[model samples]
Target: MNTSIVGTGVAVPPNVVTNQDLVKIMDTTDEWIRSRTGVRSRRFVDAGTGTSELAAEAALAALADAKLDALSVDAVVCATMTPDRQTPGIAGALAHLVGLSNAVVFDVRQQCAGFLFALDIADMLIATERAATVLVVGAEVHAGYLPWGDAWEIVLGQSTREPSAEERAVATRYRAWSVLFGDGAGAMVLQRGAVHDTAASSGILGSVLHTDGAHANLIEVPGLGSLQRPYADAAQISAGLQHPTMNGSALYRMAVECMPEAVRQVVAKVGLGLADLDLVVAHQANDRILEGVRKRLDVDDAIVPSNIGNWGNTTAATLPILYHELCQTGRVEAGSLVAFTCFGAGAHWGALLYREP
Candidate 1:
């Protein structure tokens, strides 16, 4: 048996923040941001909306695309690093908001590898006969974490007021990262296939995920941790601990080195080679990294598509969102073999393969 992703959908906020927009409030230029991250523009959520709202909307769209009713979903797994609250997770709230009342809901945090993790879990649930239909979602509202400062009025478009020189200095501290992310959600519906199916022609062929926690500190937001006397405090905020710090060189090296290998390893699992792949829906970490993977694998530019120039890095949402957009273009032809890969902050990474019916 196989677990096939039968439907896909994505949702992004209405607001578009261009590289030109970032230059207004930060010590950066359009050329600096684009030449480094390949991002021209990205979506930012309206002031009040959070992760769950975007996830719920994407979930509903996935159900509709699948021609599925919410009641028919047997399980819902949400993957995110950002959530409105801690206790219940976005899965529970998303289930409630999307009417997936009959589904057993939960959440997973695999950083950028999140959607891949969700896909693996859904495959297990379907293969084991535990659930016939599973909805997996990847969403993030990165703006909430971006060092908004007093410039929130400008970033959120609440006011025409310009950020002061002092406000610009504050944002400059994190511009390298803040400019590379956006807010959005993407989801897909996975359904069980017939028991007679063969691995030679099945959905979700296999997934290989890896973690290297020794380097977890390479990317981190320091304020909230169980080891802290208080998970978070004004002191942490005063020290700018709420914003993330990272080792970009190390991450870029890791991605360019690891992803192509993971892709090869995953395809080999199903007795296929890199040449057999028709499309590679990789995580939109950076256009340069994607290019590196493409060049290393020696695949045609058309086979490896990217949306980072438009969406920036929506973290876990990147893969599914890109996949949905590709589907809309009718480029994923029938019987096409697609490969997915992602690497993210916990040093987590993985690659999965699937075949179109």
Candidate 2:
């Protein structure tokens, strides 16, 4: 049997922080951010909000798009690195919020490879007859973990001509993370498609997922997890232990290498080649990384589409959000062969090939 992503939805916080706005609080320039990451602006959440809010909204929207009632959903799987809390998980909380009262609910943290993980799990559930419908979501509230800065005020449309008391309290730190991440959520509904579906039909074709824990340290929040409670005091915060760290050069190299290979593995598994694909939705890590993958695959611009310029990197939300936007454009019509790939903090990477219906 084939699994189909019947509906898709995305929601991003309203506040927009432009590169020009970052210049006031950081040492970077608009040209520098754009040339490096291909991101001109990104959205950040308001002070009191969290990822669950975004996830819930996106989930409901996806259900509506699928023309599915919440009660009909048999499972809710959320993928996120930035869950609102330690217990109950985002998927559990979201199930209640979205009225999937009897559904199996859980969350997975595969970093940027999260949506791919969720898709794989949902597909298996459908294929095994364990579930009739599954709702998968990828959401992030990375902005909350970023060091407080005047950029927050600027993004929120408040006066930051002078740094506010709250902004001044944080001190200048993790400038790169602060400027690169945005808050958003994206979701999709999956169901069993016709058993005889093919690339010429509308359903999933093949998928590949990989992980290398030895390289996990390349991109991580050195301070956030249970082993390290770095948010306890001012000294810890000053040590840069409260936010994520990255070996940029290493990550970029791996992403460029892994993403394309995963794409190829999935394409070949389904009896197709790069040339046969209609669209390639890659992780919104960086514009340069995606470009490297595109060149390595020898595909043209039209096949690989991107939204990193406006949304920055919403982590796990990137792939589904990109797919949702692409669907809206009518560029990926029924029966079109579409592929997606992503690499993130876990040293995790994955790819999926699907046919639209």
Candidate 3:
């Protein structure tokens, strides 16, 4: 059986925080941010809302696009680093919100690589006859965890000596990330079908996924996981260890190296090459990373399209959101050779290849 994406959708919070707006709160300038990350604005959810809400919205929209009811969905797989409560999982919460009472639900966490990971899971379920249709969603509420501006402001206010080299590095990295992230959700409806029907031109071809935990600390929330429990301690919270941190230069190097290699692997798996792909959808991490990968593959700029300028990296939601936007613009058409890839925290990286539906 083949797994085919029948529909796609995306939902972003209405609150658009532009670079000009960020300048008021963070030590940054609009020109500097745009020059570095190619981001102009990002969306932020209001208080009291979380990933599940956004996932539900995107899921419902996807269902509507597929002309299927929520009750008809056989399963749901939500990919996210930010779950609503972390116990029941974002997939369960989203299923409940969308009234998919009977569907099997689960969550996958691979940070920016999450959406591709979730898609692979859903594809397996249908390929094995465990499901006829599945709803795969990638949603995140990153704004809540990204308080870099506030953290930096506090440090600047309380510092007595000029910050040490280490403190300066931390501040600089977080400042860059704070301007690079946004909150949003995206989803797709996948259906099982004949694997080799000549009439069918659109379906998932293959995928390649890789992880290197040895460099996991390149991007992480240090004090929240089981290894560093008691995350609620005032000391941890005050020190800002509860929020995400990263070694920006290291991560950038890793992303450019791994992402294109994964893409090459998946394309080769399907007996194609970089020149064969019609559109390359990369995770909206940064302009530099995307450009690096594109240059490494020796492709033209138009081959890889990005919306990082309008919506900062939405982590798990980036790829699906970009897919939906492309579809809306009539860019994706039947027989188009599309490729997807992302590199993220956990040092996870992945690539997927498919034909447009």
Q: Whole-model Cα lDDT per candidate?
A: 0.88, 0.84, 0.85
The ten-residue window of minimal lDDT in model 1 covers 193-202
Worst 10 residues of 2 by lDDT: 165-174
Ranking by lDDT: 1, 3, 2
Candidate 1, TM-score vs. the true structure?
A: 0.97
* TM-score against native, each model: 0.97, 0.93, 0.91
Q: How many residue pairs clash in all the candidates, one count each? A: 0, 0, 0
Query: What is the clash tally of candidate 1?
Result: 0
In model 2, how large is the Cα lDDT of residue 169? 45
Best by lDDT: 1
Instruction: State residue 74's C-alpha deviation in candidate 1, in Å.
Output: 0.7
User: Which RMSD values do the candidates have, in order?
Assistant: 1.5, 2.4, 4.6
lDDT of 1: 0.88
Model 2 pairs whose backbones collide: none
- Candidate 3 lDDT over residue span 150-263, tens digit each: 343332233334444564455555686778899999999999754555655468889998988998889888885576557467878778877787788999999998989999
Which candidate number maximizes TM-score? 1
Off by over 4 Å in 1: 156-158, 194-200
